[model samples]
Target: MKNYLFPHIFQPIGWIMFVLSLITGIAIYSSIPVFGAGIAETLAIDSAIIGIALGALFIVCSKERVEDEMTKSIRLASLLNSIYAYVALLVGCTILINGVKFLVFAVFNLVLFPIIFVCNFRLEMHRYNKMCEDEEQD
Candidate 1:
């Protein structure tokens, strides 16, 4: 199979879904506006749009690899991290909450969670590969 970042169910269908989702996300978000107003706002981007884009890209790029032990571990780790991060935010809520600061953290988490998961996946992959290499050498 051609290597892609996500697993596309059907190429044409996937493309259609991707386009539709992206447009919908952008449309809803742009209602509030992204950057500015009228002609001044060159790019009116939103986190929702980014999320949609990421989902589409993920589907396009997903590999067919089965979940191995290490893969499972990585997923568990990422999930734990995400949960902890969310809990931390919840705990932080008790401290003090400036709306803007909270919004920033929310956005940051939105952008960050996937990145953290991807990194964790890579870390597990590396360990798995290294172990395999050692076994081969032995």
Candidate 2:
């Protein structure tokens, strides 16, 4: 199968960046003064955005351990499931939240897509490996 992914190293780096970005974003948001705006303000916003984008991209694009047909199939399934779950979440949030709150949640859902896909993919991979192990033991 044609495996479309980055080198494995990128995955860990991506995780690091993801965490750092969260911390940086929090710091930026907290440090922004009510009345003051300057270079730090702009830098904080830019850095946080760049960090999150790069991190999510790296993690999503990183390679699996064995890029075989089975892995590809699992990845595809996980992606589809994630999409379904995201849509469900969006719908639920839309029904529960109103106005700006719903808009914020929608934005959150957009950013959460990659993270959800990665989580689902890893969960499916783990289940697949467990099944294989059980079969081998049997």
Model number with the top lDDT: 2
Give the Cα lDDT of each candidate: 0.54, 0.77
What is the C-alpha lDDT profile of model 2 across 1-138, one tens digit per residue?
465689989989998987787677666656646324688677766677677778877876787666677887897898899899988887887789998877756645645777687789878899999999999999
TM-score each candidate: 0.48, 0.75
Residue 128 in candidate 2 has what lDDT?
95
Candidate 2: TM-score?
A: 0.75
Scored against the true structure, residue 106 in model 1 reaches a CA lDDT of 62
Clashes of each: 7, 0
Q: After TM-score superposition, what is the CA distance of residue 132 in candidate 2 from its true location, in Å? A: 2.1
Worst 10 residues of 1 by lDDT: 1-10
